[model samples]
Each structure stands twice: as C-alpha cells, then as structure tokens.
Target chain A: MIQRKKSLQCRHVDAGSCNACEQELTALLSKELDIQHYGIDIVASPRHADALLVTGPVTDTMQPALKKVWEAVPKPRQLIAVGDCAAGCGVFQKAYASHGGVDKVLEKPDQTILGCPPDPEKILDTLRELMNS
Target chain B: MSEASRVENPYNEWINDNISHKKAGDVWLALTGYRDGQIKSHWLRANGRIDEVKTACMDAQFASLTPSLPEVAWDEREIHDLFGYHPKGHPDLRPLVRTPRWPASFYPMQKQSDDHIEWTDVEPDNPAKVVEGEGITIMKVGPTHAGIIESGHFVFSIIGENILHLDAHLFQNHRGVEKALESLSVQEAKPLISRICGADTVSHQYNFLSAVEQLAGRKVPEMIEWQRIILLESERILSHLNDLAQIPAGVGFTVAHQRGLAMKEMWQKGLSAIFGHRFLFDAMYQEKLAVSKKEQLQQLLASFITQWHKWRKLADRQQGFHDRMRGVGVVKRDDAEQLGAVGVALRAAGVSVDVRTLMPLYRHNRIHIPQVTGGDVEARFQVRLQEVEHSIALIRNALEHLQGNQQDTSWSIPDDLTGEAVSYSESPHGLNAHVMQIQNGVILRYHVKSGAYRNWPVLAFAVAGNAVADFPLINKSFELCYSCADR
Candidate 1:
C-alpha cells in the first residue's frame, strides 16, 4: 500500500544548531535540484504538510514549540528527526540537564536520519524512500 | 600559591603584575595578561578595589584592564564572563554567549554543590541612544533566513552599506552538553564530542578523548594515535569543503553554491561508506578495524580520494567560483594578528598557526602537517583545499603505519583534581580551545574559547566597507563553528 505522503505539514526547528541543516534544506528547495526532485513540496502553512523534517535535538525549552509544531502538523503525520541529537542526541546526550534526547519528547520517531548534521545523502535518501513507498 | 604568587622570573613577574585576580565561591583565581600564548602580567585576583577608575574598572559588574596591558585584555572579559568573577572595570559588559538574562547573583561555574534554586534573571540597561548613532543603522537578520544554516538572529548596525557593528544573538540554548552528556559514560561521551561541531566531530572527539586521557594520565596505543590523526584529517576535509561551498552561496553564486552543496554530499557519501553514516561518525576505530584502520579505512579512503581529486579539479576550474570568491573578505595580516585569529582564517590571512602543527594533541605532533597562507576568502578556500590534500596524505601515512593496539581506547578518566588544564585543537574551522577545572572525576567547569568566537569579531571588521550583499559571502569565508560558542 502507498503511504500516500501522509497528511501533515513539516516544520524545521533549530536545536542549538549552527544552521548547516537549514542551509542544506534551502538547497533542496533551490531552483537547481528543485524540491520536486524528491516529491517534497514546501507548504506555506504547517497545517497543510504531513512530515516534519525536524533537525537538532529536542531542547528542554524547545519542548513547548516542538510539541506545538508536532501537534500543529496534523494527526497521523509522521515526524522525521534528522541529525545526531534527533536520533541519539549526539554529543549533547552527555550533558546532565538535557531532557535526555529527542526520544524523551517523541517516544518513537517516524524516521530518524542520524549524522553529525547529516548531509543531503541522508536527507535525499529518506525522501526517496518515502516518495517511492 | 599559584605560579603568580611565586614568580621569581622576570617574565613571570611581569605577567603576574599586570594581571588581576578574584575569589569566586572560595576558589583562588588569577588573571594574567596574555601575549602570544604567554601571560605577560603579574597575576592576582581583584580584592575589591576602592578606586574603580584607578584599577581600570568602572562598574560593579566588570573590571577595566586594557589601559595597562594591551593584548592582555583579550582574555579579561572572557575570563569574567565564563568564571563569573569580575574584571571589575571591564569596558564591555556585553554577555559573550551567556544571555543578558543570566544573573550575576549566581555563578554556574563556582563548584555547584547543588543547583536547587530557580535562577534569577538580570535586566540589561537599554540605552536611550541606540536608535541613532553616527555611521550606524541597525539591520537585523535571522532566527530566520534565506540560506539553510543554523537558527539565531544577528542584528547588524551599518553605516551606509558597511557593517560597523554586529550583535550575534545566539541563545539557541542547547548547552545541555553538560546536561545532555550526563547519562553518557566516557565510552559514549567519546563519540558525542564528534558531533559538537558537526564538521569537526572527529577533531572534537579526538581532543575530548585526549583531554580525558590527560586527566586520567593514560596514553593510547601508538596505533590508535595513528588512527586518530587520520580521522581528524578526514573530518577536516569535509569541514573545509562545507566552508568552500558556503562562501559561494553567501555571495549569491546560486549555481556554484548548489554545486558545492552537491559536492559536499558526495564527500559525505564517501565518509558514510566507511563509517556507516554521512558524517563518518560513531567509533571509526571499531575494535575489529582498530589496528587495521590504515588497511581498512585507508583502502576505503583511497577509493574516495580519486573521486575527490576529480571533483576538486572541476571545482577549481569553475570560473563562476573564481568570480564570486577572489578578494571578498580580505583579512589583511596585521588585522588578523591583532584579532589573534587561528586556523585557516589566520593562515589565509598569513598567520600560520595550525594547532595540529603548533600544539599537536596526539600523532598530530609526531606527523608532518602542511601549511598554507592566502589571507583572503580565496586564500582560506585554497588553504582548506590544500589541507584536504594534506589530510589525505596523512591518512595514507597512518594506513602504512596502522597497528592494532587497544591500549589508548580504554575510556577511563582520573579522580578529582581542582587544578586547571587547557587543551587546544586545530578544528576544521580553526583553533578549538578548552579550559577544564576538574573535581571528583567530573568537569567542575569547562570553559571553551573556540575559534568561532575569535573569528566572529574579526568578521565585523572584514565586512566593514563591503557591500551589504557581500555580508553572507564574507561570513562564509571563515565558516566559524557556532557549536563551540553556542555551547
């Protein structure tokens, strides 16, 4: 059965990030590759998209907005946690004060692309995997 | 008594004399003038001074120290900010990374026996005169943007089109490294450091482990040392690649920038093949591949090198790249020095200080490292590309000498030691400096003065007089690591 692009809006959040993922995401939407290459469309409103391409770790403070965004993304929509912290909380998992990792917030990630701020390979790979299915 | 108290040597006395000291939460402290890595003052912490101006201090919050020793003040405000003591008369009280909301009533670094209370906030003095100043028009960017980079807002004050001042507003507060890292044992913390910069994870990891090893006074097997240098260099290659790619994008080289982005993915794919992730993260020196790092990783690396070489050739030949980069962000040698910039930013500006070469943390000291000088955006680009070349060569060297030794991989740290230790690594961006005050096998307070912070201020000077369009381009030339500072 086709996953049918799920019915959700995607939001990219920065969790103590240096913007590497943001830059790469913009490049995805760049006129060059075009988001259509991966069947990814930029929805102006979060209410319209299905997958949240969440980057960075789930911050203690960011928990409110993260929850809001996830809830805001519409139900049954999947959350794609990108980068190190989203999956395993990367380098920051050691800091005693973090809410532990992204899992502490989103118990089960719909999809996790782990990298130290993953490159387009991981991003594109997942997009392809989703679009194909 | 610190060396400051027992300074019989003339140089040490001079360093101790002009220095300031303070007692923070019952800990003796010393503030010494820093000169070319030498502390140039007789050090002593401030014992609450009566004449504020006489002591180069003005307000209750900060102390003034520049009038006496010139370059010494570089570390003063930083010392004050990180330690929560006073450089009492410091002319600049601008919180470095600590938000203005952070209260001075409590210090985070002062041996926290308990972090029980709700933290109080302090209000910043908003001046009545900020709206209009000569040659200053405030221009704010972010917490949102056109490019895909990290989140944070930057408010730039421009005089006409030139950026006269820049206020970096980063409170993305993921510092939860001290917090995030708590559940992790040394085995896990070892790999997490690699993710700190995303670009310099290997370098960060190496330095982190090296610091831990130093704390424990343990040495890795000579073979692991060799493996570390190789991984460090591979990490350097991609880091520089990202910087090269970003510079073009910053300057509106749409096609060139996209190509750079695509090119980065290719290199990352090369990394992913060997390490199972795009970032080559996780333990590259897996127990099975530990001794055979050179044999296993090197073979894999050699396969990628051929592809990378071709990509480099294509990137180098791109006229559009040449057009966009050339002389943008020209950090002249004198300016670079006074700013005390490190890494490729310094090298591009003609200051050849590579921590890998200057203060090698491991095999870096033993191995031969390459050096370059271009001092411009193009120069930084050239330096990075050449270093990537050198990195490949160094990895090959590691492979030839790759041995399997588990001695260094043991993730053990030592018991409490209140003394201070400073560790410097040549991160892909530049110098990553970490100062640790350890107690009971835990870091009491780890103060980081990363290359990002050093290069960030100088960026304002570089962007000055340049067109507003060039701001992003100029900024990318350095690609300063924010994680180091954001932490």
Candidate 2:
C-alpha cells in the first residue's frame, strides 16, 4: 500500500485588517467546512508550512511580522492571498493605515479569492487547484 | 397592595402634588452599563442629574454581573466626551474612542457643537500580568487578524504550551454606531442599528423593534412576531452553521471545514431564497422596506424552512467530521466567568447563561431551550450544533403560533414624549445591549455594548495551556469578534 502526501501546507500571517479572514481561513477545517479533504492545513509554525496564506492589506505597522513569517517559512513555499482585502486591500484599501495591498509586497501569489470575506468553498477550490498543478 | 387585586398607580398622588415643569436646567443622560446584555439606562437627570437620581428614585444596581462596571466604565468617559457631564468620580479618565484634545467647550450631544476632527492616540492598554522569569514569552496578536473577521488584538504569555496570562487590546477603530443613531426616529433608525454587526443584523433589528414595541406600548401583530422569529431562527441557523465549519479550519481539519461550508451555504441559500441575501439582514424585519405580497412572502418562507431542516440532517452525518472537533479547546466555568465570556463559550464552560433564558424576551419565553455544557472547544462546537437544532424547533413553534395573530409592520414615533427605553438581545458572540434615550421624537442618545468586549479577553485566557498549534482552535471556540468590540 502506498500513502499519498499532502501537496502543500500553510502558515497564516494576519498582516492587518480585522480577524474575519483569520477566522474564516482557519475555520476552513471544522467539521462543518472541512478543508482537509483538500489536503491543506493551516500550521501555526512558519517553518513547517509549505504555503503562506497571507490575509491582510498588510499595514505598515505589521510589515515586520509579515516579512518575518515569510522569511521563517522555508524555501519553495507558495503564497495564497485569500480575501479581497489581501488581493487588493478590499474595503480597507482606502484607509490611511494600509500598506497598499498584499500584492505590493508578496509580488506574486499562487492564488487569490475576491470577497470582503471570500466564501469557504472558494478557498477549498484554490487548494484543490494547487494540488492539481 | 392585595394579592389578587389591581394595584393603582401609587405615584398618582405624588404626581398630582408636584407635577410642574420648572427650573429644569440641562438633561444629563449617562448610559452606565453598555455590554453585559443589560441596557445602559441614562440617568435622565432633569435639572442636576445627581439631584434627579436623589429625588426621582431608581431601582437595581447590578445582577449576577461580572462587575464589568470597572471594565466598561470607558463608556462613561465617552458620555463625558460628548455630553460634558462627568460620571461623578469616574475611575479612569483616559481617552476612550475619542480625543482628549476634544474641545472642552463643545460636546457632540449638545445640539449644535464644533466637530472634533479626530480621536486621540489610543494608549496601548497594559497587557494582563504574568509572574516574571518563567521562559514565558509574551506574544501579541492583533486588533487585526488575517482574513475578513472583525478587529481585536490578543496578547498571550505562554510557558511552553501553557498560557501564563492573556489580555485583549480592544476597541480598535469601531465607529460609534449606537451613539450616532440617537437622533433618528423609530422607523428611521431600525436599519442603522441592524447593520452594527454584519453577522448579527437580524438580532439587532429584532431587538430594536421589540424595544420600540415595549416603549410605544403597542402590540405587535402575531404575524410579525412569528415572522421575526422565523428570521431570527434563520439568522441563528446560518450563524451556527458558519461556526460549525469554522472549528476545523482553525486546527487544520480541512475536511470538516469544507463540509461546514456546504452546510452553511445550504442554510444561507434557504435564507437568501426567502429574503434576498443569504446573511438574512433585511429578512429579519420589515423595517420600512416595502413588501407588496406579505402573504406570498410568508408562504415562500414556510416552504424554505421545511427544506432547510432536511438539508441540515444530511450535512450533520459527514464521515470523520466529528474527529476534528471532539475536545479541542476547553475553557473552565471559573475561567469563562473571570474573562467575562458569554454565548456558546460560556455555555461550553457550563455557565448556562443565554439571554433568551437568563433574560427572556419576545417569543423566547414561549419556547424552552435546554442548556448545554461540554466546557471545551468541542463543547463550544457542540453548543452551536445544539443551538441550530434548537433554532429549528423554535422556528417551527413560532410558525405554528402565528396562525391567527395580526402583524402591524408600519411604525411611527409616539406623538408625545414617552421618556426613554433600554433593550437587549444576545448576538452570535454573546449579549448585545442598546442604551437608548429619546425626547421630542428623536433618539437623543444611543449607546451599545456588544458582547465581544468581554469574550475576546476571556478567549485569551482559555488558550493558555493549549499548544501554540491550537491557538486558532481555542480562538474559534470563543470566536470573539474584534469588530463588535471596536464598535
């Protein structure tokens, strides 16, 4: 018998904005909205995760923590920008505090889902898309 | 005062003796208690507020309370900010959501006043204390977190996996919702309050309408009552379903999270079919929104509820789902109280305090909801599942009860001033209280206390002892909304 390994893992960095995305992103694994079927786990330790799911407009104040998490995650890891705020700062982009957008820093993202709070299914599908690629 | 006899107004003789409007200086209104699911009753001081309290007489100070009067006393500073009347020895005089530089000469509530352009810099609240020298590093999460949830920051000190101390850095830029709506008419202001917390819009609207009904001394039609209950239940089911899916994602149980999404979407779709949006904001009440066919809409809602129950049954039986959520993060009863947690978090900790039961309101008194206690992350998870099930039962009962009741959705302000009123309802997070003051057909003052003010801090405490890996797990157990606190 052969065991199949997960395609990728994620360490979430809450750069700025409220915790809605953090809750929704992590909640992807509950019995109600299972993300494991898609082979993704939101690891607390950056070193252990294969992907970095960065949710934020990445405010100036949180830049150090954001970059530190990115540095901590080992090489060859991809980035998944989940939520409209992360993708393009969403509703909060207009605010003075924001660091523009996630793309402004991360440069390239493996995926992006657009919604003030993106739907859970959209998140699962993004991981599935990663697994296939 | 005989046992079975109608008691006459004992104040009749008192009112006749000294009922004259004279020498009333400025009416000072201070909403003392905002969050704890209790209304912040304004002092309603006619001349000197202190003199009125001494002369007019009021009853009740606190009830099974967390002594949160100290914690939430910040609102008093706010009352002072906009009204210029001090809380007579308010303990903390620091800035709370407003500028210290706000002109002392002008108060926002003083009819016409200079608008202060901004807020004073928020002083970082002192983190919860922990004994020094234990290799416990203090790690602080934000008023901001990743993704779309509301804002709040948690500072955690941990000795290895054991949490040493937890304090939440709260009230990060929550626009003053309740305070701004004080001047709106009853019909004009329902939607504004409803949008206070996006997730709990239904409950907020319902709470206001119920309070309005109480204040107006008007009888709400049976149909409206039942319809409101249906909307409330729809809101509850969708919210709990949302919570159910959330638990697994926190700790990396993707399968359960996915299952939760489908289940939640199913519930949301049923709601969207009945009311336009899946979140069920406008559906909760007919607040000035024109409804052409009330009977047809009711029929549509009736059919949707039947389908929702069936869909939920299939979703609950997903395989390997429960494994991810059996006993993840646990908050003891003592800890839950100290941290001032509420809703499913408190129930999971075995406190058994639901606003509907602890403080019965509307049709909640008609239905009986059994208290559930598991006292862990899984317990919190189970509580929500149970609540969804309970919501189903309550919805069914409300629909049946609405058969011959009349519902008057049309609302108007009272022609004569009827004083002020306070209202409360439990939002998804915990207890939500609205302190409202009205005079001359306008909401003179509005102050809100959303439950998240207490829950997030307690959630920080609950996470102690759990592995850092489980921070999100413990977090979702409480699911404290920073936005609610910020607001």
Candidate 3:
C-alpha cells in the first residue's frame, strides 16, 4: 500500500503508438476501473497537469510536438511512460521513423508501466503506489 | 494459378468501361505495383485480383484515377510520396505522411536509399485548405485530442456555428511499418501486422495469415477455422462495445456510458480469464484450447448475454441521449457510396456491403449482417448495437457447434512461398484488406487498407452543414482510428 495525497492530474500524449494502450487507458475511465475515484484524473491541457503520461514510441514526426508538450507542463513535473512501446520502443523501436521510447526525447521517465499495454488494474496499482511514495 | 495476373493499361478507362459496368460490388482494393522501372495499378475485383501491369512510368508522372474513383485519391498520393511516382492530375497531392522537413528528393520506399533522415525544424503550416469569407473562421483541433485517443489534425471551416467544411490531416504517427516489414518472413511480420491496430489485432492477424495461407495453398482444419471465427467475433463484440460506450461519453450521458462500459469490462474480463490476454494478441497462435476451458468460457459468455440485455435496455431508455445522436452527422447514401465507405459507416448508409455476407468465408454464411439506414449518428450507434447482439449470437452458435469437435490446430508455413495475394476481412470498423508481395519466402511489400482508412473521407462529408458543437458526437459515431487510418 502507498501513501495518499491530493489527486494527481495527468496529460496523455500518443507519440506514434498503435493505440492498444489507449484502449486500456479508456477502460480506466470506465466505472469499473474509475481512476477518478482514486484521485488520478486525466487533464485536457499540459499546463494544468501535474505529470505527463506518455504512450507508444516517440516518432520522428511527433518528436518536436512531444518536446513542446513536455515544455508546457510547469516545473516539478513528473513524466510517466506507459506501455512497452514508450518504455523501450517495443515492436516499433529502431524503425527509421521512430526514436523508440519516451526516453529518446524526454530522458528517463519517473515511472514506467509495462505490458503491451499494462492492464487497467496495474495502472491503478502503480498510481496508488506512486501516491504513497 | 501461380502466374501473376494482369488487367489492362489506362486503368481509368478500363474501370469506367469494364469494371464499373459490372456494378457487382464496390472497389475493394487499389494499390501501386512497382516493377523494373515501371508502375502498375492493381485493383482487386469482387471475383479476383486484376493487375494493370503498365499503368504508368517510373518518372514522376502518371494519369490520375482519383477523378473517376475518389477513394483511390489517397492511395495515389501515398504512392507518389513513397515512390516519387506523381499522379499528374490529382486535385490535392500535398504530402500525406511527409512533413515539410523531409527533403523532396528522399522517397523512403524507393529502391535507392537516402538512409540518413533527420527531424525537420520547419514551422508547421496548416495543410488543410480553408474557405475564406466574412463569417468563415478556421478552427484547428488535434493531432492530440481532449481524451485518451490517437492523434489527428482537423481543420474546420465554420460560419458562426455551422460547419462549412472539414479537412482532416492524419499520419502524424506513421511508424513506417511497411518499410520495417521489407525483408521479414510471413511469421516474422505477424506481430507487426497484428499491432497495426490493437483493437483489430485478431482480424489483422487472421487476414494476413489467410493471405499467406492462400499463397501457400494450405487449408486450415475445419474445426480450427470455426474456432478462428469465434476469435474474430469475440474481437468484434468487445470492439463494438467500446465504440458504443463512446457514444454516451460524447453526450455527457454518464449512466449510459457506465452501463455500456460495464458490459464491455465484463466481456473483456471473461476474454482475459479464458484466453491469456484481454485483446487476445496471440491467442490464435495457440494450437488448441482445452475442452473443459472451452466449456467454461461458453458458460461465462452465456451468462454475459443476460447482463447485456438488462444494461442495453437501460441505455436504450435514455431520451436525452437519443436527442443528441438522432440526426447528427448524416452522410447520405450517395456520398458514402462515392467515398467508398466501409463497415458501420457504409452499413449505416443502407448499403449491405458486409464482407461476411458478400463473400461468405468459413462459417460466416450462417450469420446475418444487420444494417441501419439514415446515415446519421443514431444509425451508426444502432448498427453497432445490433452488431454486438449479432456477434453474441454468432459466438454462441460457434460454441454450440464445437461441443464434440476435435481438429488439428497446428499453425505452419510452407517452405517455399513466392506469390502475391490479397485478403479482405470485415473489421469492426469496416473492410480490413492486406496486400502482400512475397519472393523466396520473404515479404517484399506489405500494404493494408483498414476500414478506418476507407471511412475517414466520410467524416469530412458528414461534418459539413452540421453545428460545431455536434462535432464530437458526429466524430464519435464514426469512431475513426487515426493510427489505423495513418498506418
């Protein structure tokens, strides 16, 4: 079990992902997972976000846009990388069009959720753990 | 049977005179065939594959076919971008995947290599052509949406609240998967192909493997084929549920959204418990399911239908929900047919182009394709709801037939495979076609035209004359996947 605090607000960015992870993320919004109840909310803007949630691998096309997004969040911002693609570039890594993983553009993430898309429960658990920490 | 088939040159005329005259069905496939300093147009007929062997030259010049077949407009532009074979009279041939930073001389898919590529610093200009007038205002949205969804750029030309025009620019996340699949074997490419669209993993894998199987002249055992159908229906059921759930989400109808998602979660949980993954990424790769486990899964699904009916009734009773969706985002039958819409969009437009019914495969002959006319947001939702019910019935039927069935489910590949084959399957979105060109067991070219790719054009048409406030509801009805379309 982890510590509890104010709800963490997150901004999600799809950097050349297959969108499998996005499905799991959407499921988190559903009543069953209900991440909002657990004090983790998905924010629309990076300025309001406490952390940046990244999915898929960083692509050459999205790299500049991603960097711009990362810069938008205020200081003391946490970066969380979700899914296999964002962690180590997964299947799309080393492709000419992709830099592979969020680290390529944003350096190492504060927390990384693994899986082709980490299950919704796992995502909640990790957030819970991060809250306690 | 082993020889490469050819259509005729001047494909525009051939299509106008011969193929269009047939009117048997719609244009299923359009791809550029690259040979020794020659470009060809390959169109898959309803009956079989037809290749226009010498349609154009290698130099940046070719007669545009988009004038006749508006659907292939995107394909022609993509061909031009990748191979430097320009379609001379294409109306809008701006870079589909390539940004301004990409050097004009560097065409990635060409035989010659300009291997070293870098990110460009060019300021992004609005590629979407906007209408200029006193009241017309261009509103740009996305490449990053408000929710957890894939990226796409939408340029809407609006006068006050009414949308005059909408131009969507996708492929922002194009990972160059086709280039990655260059020398990979059929088995080696399966993972990449399936991942092309995560929600449509099973369908993509099935279509790709079916194409390879056709090329190899191998038949899947009857029972395994039946099991494959179940896998596909399982994918269909869950995917439709997700899309349907979004409908209520778009309108802020939380109760309906929650109910829909509850059913979706219930279904996905059962899928994960029975199969290894929730999405069944490689479940088909397994030889066979244990008989007892199969029975258990069937029982679980049987109970799920009861819950689905109850939840569906509650969702159906929401009057406010129907008000928002009823007449929003209407894509008329003419526009849908002309744009070559597929899946739900096409079905909602009252065209019975369901691949299962049109070209019955495996045990799909036993299934009925449910369609809803009116081409509005409500029609698409109703179509999806009906499809979920149909998929549930299909799964149950397949399970019932598999009671005493025992068949070899071994997945194998032939040693020597050298041919080109095209396979099309109806994904939850629409027709997902995979075109593969193989030589000496290595994949030379791999191209996919997913349902999202075909139906994306319809969105622009649907949003026109609609209010800007209804854009989310309208867009939700189509449920277009930017990654799938981009890929």
Candidate 4:
C-alpha cells in the first residue's frame, strides 16, 4: 500500500462514462465544494498526477488508453474508481463494448466511491481520506 | 413488389419531397431531418399510422444515402460501424463508432455477435483523415482532453492558427448502451436509459418512456406530463447553465465562469433537495412532488431568475466578454439548415426549430422558441440565456398546473404489449430521439440518436476558419456531449 500523503493530485480518465460522475467531479470545482482548498487538485496530465481518478465502465476502446494513463501516473499512485459504473459496470455489466469496469482493466482500484454517481461531497470526503490516510 | 399491390407510405413521399430518396433506413434517416420540421414520424409512428419501409440487408451492404442526405451521413456511418450495414457510396466511410482496436469482423449490434470479444492491443494504422500540405499544421486533440470533459478525438488542420478543417472523431465513449438495453424489460431498461447521458438524463428518460408508453398504448396522465415537463425544464436550466459557465471559462472570463458555476451549483443543490440526484438522474421514477417540495422549487426558481438577471447585467457590461464571443465561431444559417443543426446552434442561426414545439405537452402551454440571427458564440450564448429564462417560466407554469391536480401518477406497461415506436424530446443540447422495438414485453431493438450526435458534425463546420485559440470558445458554445453522441 502507498503511504498517505498531505495532498492528492488526481488525473481523471473517463474510460467510458455516461458523464454523471464527471458532472459531479466538475461540481468539486464549484465554490461550494472548492476541493482545491483541501489540497486535492484535478490536474490536466496524468504525468503530473499522483492518483488516477477513473470513471465509467471500461470500454474496449478505452481499455488501452486507461492502461496507458495508469502507467503515465508517477509512482506511489492510488486509483480511485468513481461511480457504480467504475466500481462494477453498473447497468453496463457484460455489455459488448465494455470490459465491465476499472478493475477489469487496471486490476483493483485502491478505493471505490459508490453511487450511480457519488455526490460531490462524497467524492471530496473520499479524496480527503486518501490524503490523510 | 408491384406498384398496384404496394401500400404507399406517406413517410416515403415525405422523405422524397422534403429530405432524400436514399432507401437506406427511412425511419432512422428521418431523425436526422427531424429538427428542421421536414420529417414527421414520432406522432404518426406512435399512433400506428406510418408504414415502416424495411430494406433487406443482402450481402450486408446497402446503397449509401450520404450522397443525397448530408444530414443522415453520421447515421449511415454509425449504421455501418455498429450493425455492419455498409453504406456503399458513403463519402467518407472510415470507422465511426468502431475504433481501430475493435476487430473488423465483429459487429456488436448484430444478434449473432458474442457479448464479449478478445480486444487487440496492437496499435493499428491511423484511419483518421489527414490533410497534408505546405504551411499546414495538423493539431490532434484528445480522446481524453485536459479538462474534466468526455472523450472525443479532434483533428484540426490549420494554416497559421486559422483552422482549415476539423475532423472530429467521436464515439470514444461508445459503451454499447443500445445493445445492453436489448432483451431487458422496459422497467429494467429505465436505469440505463436515464444513465445514457447524465446531463440529458431527463430528456433521455422522457424520450425512452414516451416510446415505451406509445408502444404500450398508455396515455400518461396530465399531472405526470406536467411533472415530467418540470423535470425536463429543470434539466435544461442546469444544462444551459453549464454551457453558460463554460463559455466564459473558455474565454478566460474568471468572474463570469465562477459566478455561473456557483449559481449552477445552487440549482443543482435545489434539484438534489427535491429530486434526489444532482444531475437529476432517475428523477422521473420519483413520486409526485409534494406541496412543500413544489413551494421549494418555486422559491428556488424565483431566486434563480433574480440572480440570473443580475449576472446577465454584469456579463452584458463586460464589453471584452461580448467582444470575445461576437463574430467568433459563426455557423451560417444556410450551413446550419443544410447540416440539420438543432437547439441553440440551429436557433442561433435564425431557424426557429425546437422539438419542444412538436411535443404535445408543451404545445398547449405558452412555449416561446427563442432565436437569434448572429450564429456566433455570442448568439448561441444569447440563445441559452433566453432559454434559461424560458425554462424557468415553463417550470413555474408546470408547477401551477400540478397544483391541486392529484391525478394518478402510477403507470405500468400493458401485458404482452409489443410494438415499435419513435419518440423525440427537445433536450438542452437539441432533439434527442429514441426508437424502441419490443417483443413479448421486453426490448428487442433499442436505438438512441442524441442531440449531441447530430450537432457534433455541426461543430466541425463552426470551428473551421476560426483561430485555433477560439476553438474552445466555439466548442463550448455548442457544448455537445461526447458520451451522448458516442452512445
């Protein structure tokens, strides 16, 4: 297990989402949540990220990209699967185009936030815990 | 088939006269022309009055309709990719939904194809069309972009910062949602339908349920219709507000961007308080709104309008904001009409085409379809701002209609009701249509052609001739959903 850090820099990889999780993730940037204040930043590049925040049931087209993204993230990285789809493919289970979820492609995520789309607060809390732990 | 025995399809005539004679998939092709009011299939199909023209896919190849119907180009390409129905003369028949990784022989939508297939890791040749010439720089943008956005690959050919052409290769988020919905009961498919596109959840749900209800021959109660209208409008408000926020962000107007997002956040919280989901997913399945919740919504909308007016005043005062938007990314009216643009993109280009006007629920109500003539980022922005106000008015009106109307909200599918129908909803992006075919009370074939899918190609048109720096602003102006389009 990777050591807990003071801050977490996450690069979001949308393997194959309905974009609900991304919506909530975008909500984290709102003044109400302002996750940046908590020392957790959703960076642009995986190379600069300490964690990979992945959403969606991993699609066949996205699997290779997801793997490449994971590899691009530097060492001591945590993979947090956001939403039910990322956790276990949700309604998309066994669908032809998808590899099911993040776990199927990137092995197991370090943490999973469950909900059709976990609320902004839940996502923030999970990141906060990851930072502290 | 002899002409004497052949039952003449009015739809065929409608297509021939209005749209195209390309005998590919008439019903499927009609959706592309839907926003222009040139095609009418939803109500007729719902009433079981329209005869579907079915073409046999002999040798898995069909005549391309793209030569005649430029609007149905994407539909034909998608058909080629998913169902293996080759559009023989399709102008640019590179893979659409199918990326290079997907095996050439495997068609996911085909009934005989296995649900799971071995994926190839080998990087194949880039099938994306490249414009090579002197003094032309090719900039390839992401399937995964820098921002918290959905995946879509864009190839821009530029001559000294001015975009010569843009080839947007989308469907990176093709999760086979339609295929997954097949064989599932309407009830089971509800969740997936709502999840098809998060921002357009209510729109997708409205379309899917409308199709299901039409197939089941169930007349939804007025109260439920009003409730759905409120949900859909609320969703519209949220969606438009998001685009509103992003446009300013693209132009680096920090104050407007932050303020817009804050306002949007407030509305999201309000929606969550009333509907249970921030993005309003599965909102239709919720019980009828209580009087208290209705009052809460009224207060929320009232406050939002006040705040919106204040923001609009501030935004209007900022000449720089207007300067950045005005004359940037202009999609001409003629281009918009010919390309079959919908919603803000179409309306901004001076075409007063809104699917909501066609919807029976909104027809009785005072629905003002907003339009502007500029066809630029500013015009689209203005259209959205106007739409937000209209949506608020619509919600308030719907609330008034719902008050004291304690009608039955419960609905069930008729036993063994098996049929196919098309339903359209005017989503914030544009017109979203769902074609559902059922057998034995379960989905046999489920197809969704979202607004984003139709408008995506229009973005390529809008972006060309604009500086690469303005691409984000132009893209944000359209605000097409990648996942929705891909799905």
Cα deviation of A65 in candidate 1 (Å)?
Answer: 8.5
Candidate with the greatest DockQ versus the true structure = 4
lDDT by residue (tens digit), candidate 4, B55-149: 34446665554665688788877777777776666798877778778776777766544555766776522477767899998888887777798
lDDT (tens digit, per residue) of candidate 1 on A23-48: 55655664555666555765644576
Of 2 and 4, which scores higher on DockQ? Answer: 4
User: Candidate 2 residues B310-382, lDDT tens each?
Assistant: 6455446753545655665677777665554667788777776666643333534453444656677767876
lDDT tens digits by residue: candidate 1, B319-380: 77777677777888877766556678778776655656444435344533345455667787
* lDDT measured at residue A41 in model 1 versus the true structure, 0 to 100: 63
TM-score of each: 0.75, 0.64, 0.93, 0.92
**Candidate 3 residue lDDT tens string, B1-487:** 0122223343445335424522555454545546343444444455544433345453657766676668877887888777788776689898787777666676778743426676567744437779999978999987776679887778899998999999888888887887777788877887788788888888888888888988988767666676778888899998898888888888898877888888888888898888778888877766476344677777778788898888788778877788878889998888898888989998898987777654345444465666578899999998998898888777777776665546454546875789988787888888888778899899888788788888888888899999999988898898888777776
Clash count in backbone of candidate 4:
0
Candidate order by TM-score, highest to lowest?
Answer: 3, 4, 1, 2
Regions more than 4 Å wrong, model 4: A1-4, B1-54, B113-115, B124-126, B290-292, B405-410
lDDT of each: 0.57, 0.58, 0.78, 0.79
DockQ of each candidate, alpha-carbon based: 0.32, 0.12, 0.67, 0.71
lDDT of 1 at A87: 75
Off by over 4 Å in 2: A1-133, B1-134, B287-329, B334-340, B358-371, B402-411, B415-418
Sliding window of 10 residues with minimal summed lDDT for model 1 chain B:
B21-30
Q: Which regions of candidate 1 deviate over 4 angstroms?
A: A1-11, A18-35, A41-52, A58-133, B1-83, B100-106, B111-136, B174-188, B252-259, B282-290, B293-296, B360-374, B403-420
Tell me the TM-score of candidate 2's A chain: 0.87
Q: Which is better, 2 or 3, measured by TM-score?
A: 3
Candidate 1 CAPRI assessment class:
acceptable
Candidate 3 residue pairs in clash (backbone atoms < 3 Å): A2-A132, A3-A132, B7-B51
